[model samples]
Target chain A: MDTCIEKIRTICADLLAKGKVQKVIGFAEGSIPMASRPIAVTSKEDVAKLVFNATCGLNLANYVSDVLPKEGKIAVTAKGCDSRNLVTHMVENQVSRDQLYIIGVPCTGMVDKRKIAALFEDEITDFIEDGDTLTIVSPQKKEKVSKKDVLRHNCRVCTHRNPVVFDVMAAEPVEEQSLDQPFADVDHIAAMDPAARWAHFQELTKNCIRCYACRNACPLCYCPTCFVDESSPQWVGKGQDKTDINTFHFLRAFHCAGRCTDCGACVEACPMGINVRDFTRKLNKDALELFGWEAGLDMEKRPPLDVYSPDDPNDFIK
Target chain B: MNFITIDKKDWTTGIDKSRETYQVFGPVQDENGCQIKPLAPDVHPLMDAGVTVMSPKSVLFPQTQKMLTATLDASIEDHHVMKPVKKDDTPRVVLGIRPYDARAILLVKLNFDNPDYQDPYWCEAYAATTFVGLGVNHPGPCDFSTSTGCGPFSEEGLDVLMADLDDRYLAKILTEKGETWAGACGFDTRADAAESQSLFDILRKEAEKNITSVDTDQLSEKSILDLYEAPFWDDVAFSCINCGTCTFVCPTCWCFDIQDETKHKTAVRFRNWDTCMSPLFTHHASGHNPRGSKVQRVRQRFMHKLKYFVDKYDQGIMCVGCGRCVASCPVNIDIREVCTIMNNYESK
Candidate 1:
């Protein structure tokens, strides 16, 4: 991990010094333990602030659309998930391909801070990471736990561990996992009856406060004005009503049908700890089964849902 | 003031007896995390539940509160006219609320219960409730309440303060409201106030010593324009996703937006918790938004809490340093670090 960080810093610093890019967007040490914040460095001196770790859960692609200067180029330190979203951005015309540089860090996986936070009664004051071992430290006790046990749910089953697209490589690509059950979680929900599925969704969103953090964290949501905020013909209610909360989640998932990269940023950003990926991952499975399609894999073609075709499935239209 | 020594052995029986007189809300563990929910007939409180996922502000200010309701039927008398919905104001007790959160409630009161006009819902709920605060023996790394004019044992808004003593609970009754609830709970083993006060002092000092304070003294002295126009504003707000997570989880964030929803001949007007992080929070009906960009919106959140609140009432910043925003922010937009930047900034 330290070697990966060193490689990332060197690459980003060179980009800044050579005037190849005006800013480098990457992760930095957070104020708290087991947390890392996305940082933007503009000078070579500031590139030392950059870091790469398992705690960098947020997708750096979420910042590309807003943080990029109108004329100057900006570089992003991307993981496998982030690089895919950047491809989505290029396809959607959110950011031009030429003005962007990707510093691809082939990810092992990010750790789920929420999962680790729940294991202790007191605050996690500090921790030491050594290879596959993570030493969990609290004021009461310090215990060693395997990093594999704490890997984020999305990372555990990620098939795309190598960057699909990048301008510079930060490290050698790692081995990607080929899981026996790709969409097991979604299948569990699908196997349930209609009433049971509805109850499942209701339980998942019952704690939602309508914060919209999930929407803002996804790279696919680049609309000037989201449908939720449109008042002329209001689409959804802004309150905590069960119907309203479900509508917002279902609609947002439908909108991200063919574009979502299964990046897990929505799940990571959700303050309520909602695995909102359940809504979008179901669509990802359907896209694979129905159209033999995967999102952001090809830059030359539009998404299956983004285009109108004679061969497109009409069964769902009814 | 008086002290009540609640024996750990008889704690459950006392709380059960109090349930007859008051609707008790306490922290209970669930699938997601511990939540401050109403106690059911079968469920009991998890007194050791530390720093609930959401603050206890929802006790008084619900996330979505229906303020008024109306009917659009032409046959109805005074149709389209809004009327206050009758709500139950049952006597309630919030068990084990953190002292920092209690302090946050008082800070929020300055807005809802000010000189101009009092919010009926908030004031009424506040008047009907008794706050039983629980002092944190060890504050988390995120808590900086001591520097923000609040501490582990600060008793500004709570009626009673309870300190954990491993084997039992030592509760100090601070106000008349506390005594009433204590009596209802059958917690009558009186302890000496002097000894209890000294113990609380020792625990509070130990907890405060653990917290790393962030300075905001320079904010009150610095000109608002200079801080707003500082070069670091863009850099500070660079990674902000403009999500409402920071404000929604915050204990002191009290911005609300009211909207009317008419469905099937019934019109219900509600005031929902709104965040300055949203672009629409300041959007106008004319399609004009003053704080349209993310940078401007992010600036508004910090300036309001750190500068605007200070200038408005000559009080401290409108933050209790509970660290909910610091912990839950998806992008880690820490207010403590932002305060340090604002405090030491000089305009170019």
Candidate 2:
């Protein structure tokens, strides 16, 4: 982790000094334990602020679509999922290929802050990742646990540990995990009775406060006016009514249908600790099963929804 | 004030008795966490449940409420004429609410119950409900109620404050509303009022000591614009994603946006919770937005909570230090840090 951080800082400082990029977007240490904040450093002096660790979970690509360079290109430190988002952004014309300088990092996986918080009795001062073990340091004591035990659920099943595209590689790519059943969670829900399934979804969304953190944190949700915010037609009501809340989540997930990369930004950003990824992940599963298309893997091919084939399954349409 | 001791075993029986006169609300544990919800007929509230994930302010100010309703048909006698929505006037008791959250309802009341323009809906609901506060025996890590002009056992806005005393609960009835609730619950045991008061004082002091102090002495003297335009805002606002999580979870963030929805021949006007974090909050029909930048929106949230609210109401900052935002903010934007920065800000 230290070596990776040093390499990224050196490259960022060089880029800033050479004026290759106006800003270097990366992760910075946060005030809380096992959390890192997305930051944009413009000067070479501040390059040291950029650090890479198990806590760097936020997709830096979420900022790429918004941070249009005033002068040169903008450099971003992209993990596997984030790199996929960068490619999606390029394909969607949210940002031109020339406008970005991608520094890809090979991700092992990020530790879930919630999981760590549940374990520690005292305040966690630092999270030191050493190989397969994570050292949790607090005022009272320190404990070491297997890195896989604390990895985010999505990360544990992640297949793309290496960036799909990059201008420069920060480190050697790590080996990917082989999962026989990637959609075990989704299948669990699918296996339930229809009424039970309905009840499960209802229970899942009962706590939704309509904060829109899930929408805003999504890299693909870049509409200047979200459907929830539209007043002319008012596609959806802006209240916590059960129907209105359900409509908001359904449409929001449908919109990301074929375009979502399952980057986990929405899940990470949700304050209510809602498992919103379940909705999006289901969409991803359908996209892959129906069209044999995975988002951001092949830049040459358009999104499944964007392109239609005559042989496409229309049984559901009927 | 009067004191009564209800045995732990009789807690549910008392609440069951009160059901005849009032619908009960209390801290109920769900998969997500503890939240304030209406008690199911067979469910008993966990009186010792730690601080709820969300505040009980929703009891008075609902997340969404219908303010007025009107018919769209032109032929009707009173067509297109708006009438205030009638609400249930049955008294409700919100039990096990934390003392800080109870104080937050009063802070919000300053906005809804302004002398010049009072909101009848909010005022009426507030009048119909009784706040039964539970004093904190052990303050949460993020709770700084002591420094935010409230304390763990502060009885500023509660009708009754219940302190846990192991096998029983010492209920301090402070108002007629509280007396009514106690009477409805069949709380007949009388205790020495002086002894109970002394015990509460000791509990308050110990709980207050658990919370780390925050510097807020200079906020009253600090110039609003000077603190607003301070150079630290850019850094402070950098990591904020402008999501409504903090505002929605907040107990004192009372901003709302009103919209009229018309369908067929019926139109209803509803007020929903809105946050200053969104760009649409300041956007006008002319396509001009005063707070177009994320930094501006972020700055507005803190300024309103810590500065503008303080200056306007002559009350403390509009937060109860419940720590919901601290725990809820996905990016770890701690309000305590921001409060310190603003409180200590000085022109170079």
> Per-residue alpha-carbon lDDT of model 2 for B1-348, expressed as tens digits?
799998988888999999999989998877666789888889878778766778887888889989899998999999999998889778999999898898899998998898887888888889999989899987767788988899999899999999999999999999999999999999979889999999999999888887877888889899987987799888888777888999988999888999888889999999999999998898998989999999999999999889888889888888888888887787778899999999989977
Q: Cα deviation of B245 in candidate 1 (Å)? A: 1.0
Distance from true location, Cα of A33 in model 2, Å: 3.3
**What Cα-based lDDT does every candidate model obtain?**
0.89, 0.86
Q: What is the TM-score of each candidate against the true structure?
A: 0.98, 0.93
> In order of the candidates, what TM-score does chain B achieve?
0.98, 0.98
**Candidate 1: stretches off by over 4 Å:** none
Q: For each candidate, report its DockQ versus the true two-chain complex.
A: 0.83, 0.55
Tens digits of per-residue lDDT, candidate 2, A168-215, equal 999988898899999899999999999998888888999999899998
What docking grade does candidate 1 earn? high
Model 1 lDDT at residue B15: 86
* Best DockQ among the predictions, by candidate number: 1
TM-score, chain B, predicted structure 1: 0.98
- As for candidate 1, its clashing pairs are none
